[model samples]
Target: MKWFEIGLVVLTFASGIIWLLDRLFFAKARRERAGLLDDGRDPVVVDYAKAFFPILAVVLVLRSFVAEPFRIPSSSMMPTLLVGDFILVNKFAYGLRLPINNRKVVGIGLPERGDVVVFRPPAYPDQDWIKRVVGLPGDHIAYRDNVLYVNGEASAYQTIGQYVGKGRGEEMTGATLLSENLGGDGRHEVLEIESPLFASHGAGEWTVPEGEYFVMGDNRDRSDDSRFWGTLPESQLRGKAFLVWMNFDGAAGGVDFGRIGTRL
Candidate 1:
C-alpha cells in the first residue's frame, strides 16, 4: 500500500517488456509459419519506453518521500534564494507520508519557527508552496507596517541596506534588505519592496490553532503565502527545503555552477 507508485511503475514496465519481447521474437516465427515475410524489425522502442516508466516512477517516489527538487520561480525568498536557484527539500525530515494524500503515517518531528518549509497551499491545496515558518501551533501572529510580531514578542529586524535588483522578475527590483532574526536561532535576509506599501498590512492578530502553522516568504512583498490564505495544516507539509543542487534560468543563460551544492 505504501509503495503504490513504485508497484504501478514496475507493473507497467513488466507488461511492456513482455509485449515487446513477444512482438520481436515470436511474431516473426508465427508470421513465417503463416507464409508471410518477416520484416525482422525489433521493437526496442517499446522496451525503452517501458524501462523509462519505472525509472521515472522511482524518481517521483524519491522526490516525494525522500528529497524533492524545486526551482525558485519567484523572488519570494530573495537574498536567501534567487529567481533561478534550484533547491532540494528534505522530504522525510518532517515525517514520512504517502505523497499527495499527505497523511502523516509516521511522526518524526514537527516544524519550528524560522525553518524554511514546503507545503501544499492552504488556500489552494493542489499547489505546492515554500515559505518560512513564522508561527507554530497555538502562537499568536501579526504583521503591521512590515514588522512581524509573534506572541507579542516582535522579531528583531536590522536594516541592512537596499536590495539590488537582478534577473527578470519585477519583484526583485528596488527592495529593502533587512537582516531578520527569528529569536536568536537563525539570522537571514529578507526583502521588503519600498513601492508596494505593504498590501496585506494592518491585519489583526492571528492565533494559529493547534495542528497548523503560520508561514511567510522571505521576499515579504511578492509572496502569496499564509498571510493571504491561512495557516498550513500539519498534514499538508511536504518537507524541509535544505539544499541547492542546480540552478537553470533560461533568460540568464545555462546552469548556475556557483549555486550548485549550496546548502539552504
Candidate 2:
C-alpha cells in the first residue's frame, strides 16, 4: 500500500475514534466547564476530530471508490501515455475494489481488449504497472516478427509515420508509429521499435487463463510485459486509465501546458 494512503486511513480512524470517545464520555463535562452547557462545544481533541474526520473520510471515499490519479513513470506506454503524464484511473470502471488489498467486492464489468489498465504485476506485487489489454479470458495471444496475432487472425494496423519522440521519449525517435485496431475496441496508436532490446520468441504465444488478462505496452518491443512476466491476474487489477490531467517532462526541462487536459 502507498504510504500516503496508509496515513490517510490512520488519520481517518484516529480522528473518528477521538470524536466518538469524546461524544460518549467527555463532551458533556467539557461543555459544562466552558460555562454554556447547551451551546458550548468540546474544545481541543473534539474540535480536531470534527474538523479533520469528515474531510479525510470524503477524500478516502473519493479516492478509493470513484477515481484516483497516478503518474506515469516510464516510456513503456509511449505515445499513448507519456513519462510524466498524471492520469486519472476510473476506480469503479471494471469493479469496486478495496484499497490496499485490491480485492473486488463488486463486479461492475470485465476488461475489454484495447483498454488501458493499471494493475499489480504478479511478479512484483508492490509495483503498479500499466498496459493495454490484448487478450481476455480464453483468448489466444501471440507476437511474432513485430506483429500481434489473436486467435489465428493478425492484428490490422495503419502505418502512420516515423515517431519523432521528445524529451524522455527521445529514445523512441526512429520507431514506427502504427494505429492498431485490436478489434472490439477502436484503434489506438502504438510504437514498433526497429531494434528491440528484448525479442519475442515462440514463448510469446499464450492462452489466457480464466480470470487473467494478457497485457502489453503500446511501445511494443521495449516493454517488459505479459510477454516477459506472463498474464496478469484479474484480482490484482487497479483500474482503467482514462485521462491525462497534468504533465511534467523532466528531460524536456519543464511542464508542457499543452498536454494538460489532454484525454488519454
Candidate 3:
C-alpha cells in the first residue's frame, strides 16, 4: 500500500476510535464526576480527534471515489500535457474501486481509445503512470514508421509545425507537433520528431488481450509506455485524467499560470 494512503487511513481510524471510546465510556464517567471529582471538559486527545476525523474522512472519500490530483513528472504526454502539470483524475470514470487493491466495486465504465488515463503500469506496479489508451481489448495495434495503425486503419495526423518547448520540456524543442485523430471525437495533440537515419523508429506490433489495454505517450519517440512495458491490466487502472489544475515548472523556476486549468 502507498505510505500516504496507509498513514491517512491509520490516522483517520485511530482518531475515530478514540472519539467513539470517549463518547461510549469516558463521557459518562466525566459527567458523573462533574459534581465534585472533576470538570466535564473532554480531554485534549478527544478534542483533537473530534476536530480532525470529519476532515480526514471527507478527504479520504473524495480522493478514493470522486477524484484525485496527480502531478505530471515526465514529458511522456507532452503537447497535450506537460511536465510539472498537476492533473485531476476522475476516480469514478472507470468505476469506483477499492483504493489499495483497486477492485472495481461498482459501475461499468470502460476506457475507450484515445482516453488519457493514469494507472499502475504492469512494468512498475507500485508507480502511477499516465498514458493515452491507444488500443482497447481485442484490438490489433501496430506502430510502424512512427505512425499508429489500429486494426489496419492508420491514424490521421495533421502537422501543427515545430513545437517550441517550455520549462523542463526545453530538451524537446523543435519537435514536430501534430494533431492525431483516434476516431470518433477522440482528437488530441501529439509531438513527433522525424528521424530519417533510422527509418523504422519505435516500431512494434501487438494484439490487445481481453481485460487489458495498450497505452502510448504523445511524445511518440520519448515516452516509455506499453511499447516498452506491454499492456496495462484493467485491474491496475486508477482513473481517467481530465484536467491540469496547476503547473510548477522547475526549469522555469515557478508556476506557469497559463497552464492552469488546461483540459487534458
- The candidate that wins on lDDT is 3
TM-score of 3: 0.96
Comparison by lDDT, 1 against 3, better one: 3
TM-score for predicted model 2 compared with the true structure: 0.93
TM-score of 1: 0.78
TM-score per candidate, chains pooled? 0.78, 0.93, 0.96
N/CA/C clash count, model 1: 1
Off by over 4 Å in 1: 1-57, 199-202
Ranking by TM-score: 3, 2, 1
Query: At residue 114, what lDDT does model 3 achieve?
Result: 87
Q: Write model 2 residue lDDT over 178-243, tens digit each, in one string.
A: 999888659999998665454443246899999999999999866889988888999989999998
- The whole-model lDDT of each prediction reads 0.78, 0.87, 0.89
lDDT of candidate 1 over 49-139, digit per residue (tens): 6657666667767866888777777777777887788888998999998764777788788898888998877567666678999999999
* Candidate 3 regions with alpha-carbon error over 4 angstroms: none
lDDT tens digits, residue span 56-172, model 3: 999889988999999889998898888999999999999999877788999759999989999997667678989999999999999988889999999999998999998899988
Model 1: which ten-residue window has the lowest total lDDT?
Answer: 1-10
Model 2 residue runs over 4 Å out of place are 36-43, 196-203
RMSD of each: 5.3, 2.4, 1.5
